[model samples]
Target: MQLSLPFTTLLAGVLLALNVNAVPVAQQPRMVTLPLKRMEVRSDEHPRILLQQQINRASKRLALMTGREAPTEAMMTEALRKRVLEVEGPEGLERRRVGLFGATKDKRFNRTGVPKNGKRSPKKGKNAGNAGNAGATGNTGATGNGGAAAGSSAIGGPDSATGVEVANTPTTGNSLGLNIEGPDVGYLATIQMGTPPQNYLILMDSGSADLWVASEACQSTAGGDCGNHQTLGSTSSSSFVASNTPFQVTYGTGAVQGAIIQDDITVAGLTLKAHTFGVTTSETPDFADDSVPFDGLMGLAQSTLSEQQTPTPVESLASAGLISDAITSYKISRAADNLNDGEITFGALDTTKFDQSTLTTVPNVNTQGFWEAALDAITVDGQDTGLQGRTAILDTGTTLIVAPVDDATAVHQLITGSQADGQGGFTVPCDFNQSVALTVGGTVFAIEPQDIALQPPNQDGSCTSGISGGSFGTSNTEWLVGDVFLKNAYYSTDVGKNTVSLAKLV
Candidate 1:
């Protein structure tokens, strides 16, 4: 599919230069690792709700990339709510405890508490009374505060919750750590931005290409609630350069709009100078919730997919020769594992994380700028489902697998005691142990039963399958393959080679 570029004319020359600069060879290949922290699951946040959100995000991502008019978060949520009510009845809705964006009434208002000198402060706006003040510490829960302490480097101290300590000084050839929120909701990396360098927890996404963070202007002007997350702009950064160009991006669950700006961004011990990205002045509640751990999002897809029409961080690193290659790899961890051992490596693949003997590489076939490859087949309990010609978009931002409607039904029909939830999803017995595997590049990657049958059974003693039905792309065979399947393997993408490699996890 051809991507309808929004700012093709403006970015044409920049894109050409980036492509040329991406080819220079480096003396030594460098690898930076980002450790991941698993989020504490809440009883109120249902797995089904997360599944719906993932579905919405996948759809909107495709819509935005294809230049289609994407539905607003309100429209998407209302549609889901209406669908649940119509198909499952009011009792089912109540049983699932479904609310706007899957957040309960009280959960929406339950903001993260900011402690001052070991005492909890009253509920107030993000950095209240200290808006636009770089020195003021913002939400310091799960992730550390946004403000950099005096005499402190860009990296913050150890996070008590995750037990991971970020180095105070930038280390050469070292990897920054990442926090995994919820059951693989997304990966969070603490990045320093601006002149003085304030820390911001950013969601690293491979499915989309665009970097953006909430701005202090949003919090100070009452333009929108940025929650207690960190923010940066001219108010907080002396070197921040703003453009008159407007920036807006819509995700499946949320949306943000602001102005294009240029600033310095440091990630994984490497700095990308004068990086152009968005500084959000307004954002939806999906991103404005204090319970949400990430302060912003960093899209790792190719520069062509970038809405900002700027080279991605990885691309910039490659162009600047900060890294030997424009490659990113993920060793995602599951909440069930409780290991907190997940990590994302940039520049080069970590051979220690995967079985090199079983490594297989496939060309990325999606022209619309997604890390996608052909899915040859799917087998349930060692039986072929006869499905064919399907492609899977490996997305880290998504939590579950979203398959085409017919393919989802075909796979679920093979599982014993599987029933359609009437909402484009299927519920299987909680104790489902059927062997499921996906065939890609003629290699079979088996999925664990725990990964297939999600946690927390429904009131009817049924658990939601990690796979659901959804529509994306022109053909119905496209699948949004997320952490549900990715966690079981070592997934990596080589931007320069335009190939995706998957290997058995060691």
Candidate 2:
């Protein structure tokens, strides 16, 4: 009873079977946009505290890029402490702490988790207060008011601890809204996860590559609760699958350690099934601060830069045919401008955000995974400063520009009345208005005078230069270019092309 058939027919049947079992073709990709919310700066926040945080964050970012362990917080603080003593004498350190932590009548500084008077000012846990908005859904402008869930709070109101007003009701579209916390802070975006979908606000960081969130059992490295932020895990999501792989990432200000897992994640009306990410069991206190607006961070850098060795969320979207191109664009807004219209677009550029005719594309030079490009020149008042052949890393996560010590000194020297502040920064007269422009890819972009000088805590007529001097890992010719410079331009990164484009804002 053997079956008989022509050779051509048999071959045709075999081919048909193979086609049925083979992988399906990817669908066409479309552009997706997300809204960004801006978190205002706290009236009580000290400039010195922000400065130190930026310094530490820059140091950590460099270390991570170079595959080295960053200096311990104690070591970094000790170095700054020595500088203070050398410049301001014995009492300078205490005075600095008082300014940063706020001084009580008795002259004692308020340290977190430390006893104030006889009672301890306990750190707020995740369940202590209401969780904010459950996140906006669809393109209809529907806002979900979160219940008294463990980590829920009312959206579009002042944060319970920080008193920073958060925006509510993101515009309807295939976009997730972004929140800009402050001038120097990074942006945050809302995302949905799990079977039924739970909303969480996470940082939209392009400087690093890895997605992570706190788990239900998470604790602070300081041996306390993990703040009043949201948490996710197998308990909250029935579809969560544990990978049993250990993961750890250390930032300049904080670190997290946990296990890698898989689940469904949705952003901007697109979903990635079985997406891989980290669930932190422990984190540093910097991230566990109750004032911190985001629950976790989602890195938008190249996959090679991922500490977990997994594809980034954007990459996953491209692979799944969710986006046509691996492009991410940012139109960050200034708090002082009060435009409140910052946004991030994935897959394609929002042509309306910038002048397409002025777009200048440059090759990304750092093969080790940063969005770095060459700095052609520096100009002050249209006069070339002779600074050339240096490179700049366009980092959205950072707040200020950190350049090599020699380069920073040279740039500052060109400005009148600019002097070293002895704290790795420079101070200039508040009224020193000059056109400072940076040349890249033969295109010149000017930085606003206001953006170059920030008011220091002293209320004196002097300002702290937004560009500071520091060493980045082992590269003395590299610059960490942050929002200070980026806010002046329309920035976009193309992973597929391995290039970065900047254009004058419209």
Could you tell me how far off, in angstroms, the CA of residue 194 lies in candidate 1 after the best superposition?
A: 2.0
Total clashes in model 1, counting residue pairs 3 or more apart in sequence or in different chains: 7
List ranges where model 1 is wrong by over 4 Å. 1-29, 45-79, 82-173, 219-225, 471-475
State each model's CA lDDT, in order: 0.63, 0.64
- Clashing residue pair totals per candidate (backbone < 3 A): 7, 19
Q: CA lDDT of 462 in candidate 2?
A: 73
Every model's TM-score: 0.78, 0.80
What is the model-wide C-alpha lDDT for candidate 1? 0.63
| Residue 8, model 2, lDDT | 7
State the lDDT of candidate 2 residue by residue for 1-506, as single tens digits: 00111110000000000000001112223777665556544333234434544555565555555445555545555554554455457776666654332322111211111112221124323222222233343111223432211212344443333333344333324655666666545777767777656666678887778899888788986677776566777777788898779988765445688999999987765889999999899976556644344578888888887878898888888888888888888887776676656777788778777888889999999896678889999888888888778888898877778776777888898899898865567777788799888898889999988788876433456777888876554556777888889889988898999999999988
Top candidate on TM-score is 2
